[model samples]
Target: MKISNAHLRSFRNHNETAFEFGTRVNVLLGENGQGKTNALEALSFLCLTKSFYASADATVMQQHGTFFEIKSVLLSDKGKEFHVRVTYDDEKKTKKFTINGADVEKFSSVIGMFPVVILSPENSSITFGSPADRRKFVDLVISQSSKSYVENAMEYRRIVRQRNMILSEAKGKDCSSEIAPWNEMLITYGSRIIGKRNQFLSEFAPYIAQTYLDIVDERETPKIEYAPSISIKPDSSLEEIAAAMEQKLAKKKNDELRFQTTLVGPHRDEIIFSLNGMSLKHFASQGQHKTFLVALKVAEFFFLKERCNETPIFLLDDVFSELDEYRSRKLLSLAESLGQIFITTTSEKIFGGAEWNNERRKFFIKSGEVAQEPVTA
Candidate 1:
């Protein structure tokens, strides 16, 4: 998919900004804190129905403004166009998303409609951070690709929260009678989530491996292992997963009361990344970490492209700043060959010897505005 154009109003530092994007590579060039990332965030909001980084919609609104709006024209791979608009009213604490003038009541439904893959500096945590970070990364990728996954995840979270509340109120006492219904619900939804995650990890293994081989010349074999909270094999059926969850819940009943939290669910899962059998977190260098993270994202792009109806748009936020010239150019070449991509960088020197045309244009951003004419060279 390609974003043909976008308009931003009262978003971050952008009081009013408009963009006419290219079909291939559109670069946003500017110095730090000049709203380059904000523009890219707007595009993400347009596609995902929420901000990529910000936890609250109000955080992205202008300081003195009570609302924010983003409108865009998106083109699908199958020669279809989508007019998407996202608006927020801080006064009423309401956020609305519309596609082609029709209001989308459920934001989850709009997820894979315009598939997207995002790689930002914050994504470094996927490799170097805690297991929760890794789970978040995988969850987002899976959520976009599968429609039922999001709802299952949402219901699972609700069940966990309710169960935790019951445990907290029990104060280390046995509350089996009160929590019985929630326990069954937890096992039901939790098993579905674990089964889906297991299936996704199994399917995604090959994509990451091939992408790593395609991008890196080294003979490195990357592997992702799904360590669910419950004990089960990857090929375990839903009944087996549910039975395992029930057994674990029984074992952790006293511990859950002591901790006052749901302890036996996918929420405590871990995803380990390894390079040639060595743990990425414990053994990989900084370069290997970056490369592995990039490969995962590229793999996500292709995976979503095949799973979703539309080709996913790629967003690279200030990634080239950390890479060497060779890898930067290599990534640029590879990204351009993919579908439409938007890259944000502090310098235009990365494109020094690269080809540019109407399909690959550069926009200079300064003070939340497109500063000058798009550079096409």
Candidate 2:
């Protein structure tokens, strides 16, 4: 999908800003804290119905501003147009997502509509941070590719929260009677999540491997293994996964009572990334970590492009700052080869000797507003 234009109001440092994007590569160039990243975040909000970095809607709202709104014109691959608008009211604490002037009651329904793949400095956590970070990375990719996975994940989270509440209130007492129904629900939803994760990881392994091969010159084999809380094979069926979850919950019941939480589920699962048989988190250097993370995101772009009906848009937030010159140029070429891409950076030197035409454009951002005269390389 391609974003033709976007208007942001009261979002972060952008009091009121408008964007006329290029059909291919659009660069947001400015020094740090000049609202370069904020513009990219607004694009993410328009596509995903929320901020990629900020957790709370109020956090992204401008200081003392009561509301924030982002509206965009998106074009699908088949020449279809989408008018997407996302608005949040502080007083009412309501967030609304509308497409083509039609209210989207369920925001989750918009997951794969305009597929997006974001790679920012924060994404380094996927390779260097804790397992929860990796799981989040995996979940977002699958959530965008499969709407059913998104629904199952949301329901599973609610189930776990409710189940944990019962366990917490019991205060180490036996609450089996009260938690039994939740257990059934948990197993039901949790198994589907795990099953989907299994299928996704298996299908995604090749994408990552091919991406690594395409991006890197070395003969390194990147592997992504699913470490579920329950014991099950890679090809385990939903019934088999459900059975395993039941067995695990039975064994962890005592521990759950002591900890006052739901112990056995996908929430506790781990996704291990390894390079040539070595764990990425334990052995990879900073450069390797960045490379792996980039590979993962590039792979995600291809995966989503193939899985979703729309071609995914790639968002790179200050990503060039983290890589060497050679890698940066390589990534730039790769990103340009992809569909539509939005890049935020402080330096325009990377675009040196690069052509800027109708398909590629640059915008100078200063304090949340685009400069009247854009500086071209």
Candidate 3:
């Protein structure tokens, strides 16, 4: 799968611009603040129907532009074509995402349709940040790889919010009976979430270990363990896990009223990463943290590919500067085995030893405009 072409209109600083690409290494070469990262942001919105950096959709539109629109023509290796369009109205703050002119009722339905993985400076949180960051990465990967997971996760979140509201309303009142319905929904969805997360870690751990060794030259990976609110066997059936979660939440009802929040579910779960039985987030050096994050991302790509049977379009957004020459080369080496790649670099010197195939295309982006000529090395 590949994006054959894309047109960006009124997005960020790009008033109007379009580019065509093939299935190979394509470099968006330019200096800082040249809209190179902005282009990648557009592509991200096209794939995910949301912005990773922006808090809202319309914020990505240009100040003077009335709307932000991006349209891309996706081509599959099977000789089929998909038209993906994402348009946001600045005035009304509405977003429309469609494939082949058909309206997309839910964004998750189309997330994995054009799967993409991004390596950027912003991903540092996945390694050195809080548990929420790590859980987000895990949820995103699982959501794309499994549509049922997405539905379950979404329903779980909805149930959490409803449960929280009920707890708040019952803080000093006698509404215990009303909250039971929410708990029933929560247990149904939360158990599935916990079970899926536990199962995912078991399946994905080997890839993380191998990728960590291949990239960081480490003998052991940071030990990954899924810490759920309710304990269950790795092979526990969904019904069995739900029963356990239901009983646990029943015990926590008094505590929930005391805290005025829902406390017993996957939302409260944590993924602990340790090395040599030491907490990696607290004990690992900065370099070690970065290597673990990179390894996780690489493992993410392989996991999605193996599960989905399609190589996702890989995006490396100004991450070379974050890595030394050796790791940059290592990342490039692994990426070459895949399909389309969009790498943005502020310095051309980084490509001195880089290899590009016959299908390679390099161009310069300046002030939201794409130049046909490649920037000089």
Candidate 4:
């Protein structure tokens, strides 16, 4: 899929602007703080229904503005067109999503409709970051690719919150009986989440490994392993896993009460990345960390493509400026062969005069206005 046009109103520094986008290799070039990233963030909001940089919608709207609006025309491979619009109201503190001029009650239903993956310089440190960051990374990718995974993850988180609330209330009180129902709900949803995560890792590991080798030029194998809350053999049933959770709850009841939280579940699960039997987070160099992140993102693209038969839109936010010449060339080459890619850059020198193919287009974004232009060497 590709975005044919976008209209922005009171978004960031933009008062009102509209521009068409290329189907492939659309580069947004401008000086720092000139709204290049803002354009990319606007496009991202259409896909995820949330701002990537701002925590709240009010922060994304221009000062003194009451609301922000983004509208896009998307064309699918089957010759169908989808019109997506998102509006943020500061007074109501709410976001509204519409598709084809019809309001969508639940944002979840339209979240992955036009899947997108963003590779920013900030994402380069995901491998060296905390386990929570990696978990979110994995969850975001899986959630976009699989609706079942997203549903299970949402349900698991809801159950966790409810269970923790009950635990907190039962602290120094006699409300322990209420825990059973929430525990059952947690296990029912959490087990599916864990199972899906494991399955994703099983399929994703080899792809990442191969991509890492290609990018890093090393024969040393990198491995990714899923670490769940409970140990269950590969062939074990969900019922068995739920039973194990029950035993864990019984074992940790006193601690859970003391902490007033649910301690064991998919929320606490982690992913282990190792190279030559050493933890990558602690041992890998900065360059190695970047390579791993790129590999992980490439694997995400392929995984979604293979499953859905559609390539996801890629957003590269000033990542090329951080990489050396060789790495940048490799990334540019990889992007050239992939689906529609929207890239942001503060300098045009990074692209090194790569010619635009029939599918490629370039845009210049200044003060939140986008204009189509030829990329200069």
Which candidate achieves the best lDDT against the true structure? 1
Which scores better on lDDT, 3 or 4?
A: 3
TM-scores, all candidates, are 0.98, 0.98, 0.93, 0.93
Q: Which stretches of candidate 3 lie over 4 Å from their true place?
A: 353-358, 372-377
- lDDT of every model, 2 decimals: 0.93, 0.91, 0.83, 0.81
lDDT string for model 1 (138-172, tens) is 89988999889899999999999899999999999
On TM-score, the leading prediction is 1
Candidate 2 runs further than 4 Å off: 375-377
Worst 10 residues of 3 by lDDT: 368-377
In angstroms, the error of model 1 at 88 is 0.5
Can you tell me which runs of candidate 1 are displaced by over 4 Å? 375-377
The window of 10 residues in a row where model 4 has the poorest summed lDDT is 368-377
Model 4 misses residue 336 by how many Å? Answer: 1.2
lDDT of 2 by residue, 1-377 (tens): 99999999999999999887888999999988999988888888876778888889999999999999999999999999999999999999999999999999999999889999999998887888888899999999998988898889989999999999999999999998999999999999999999999999999999999999999898889999999999889999999999999999999999999999998999999999999999988998888888889899999999999999779999999998978889899999999898999999999889987677667888889988887654344
Higher-TM-score candidate of 2 and 3: 2
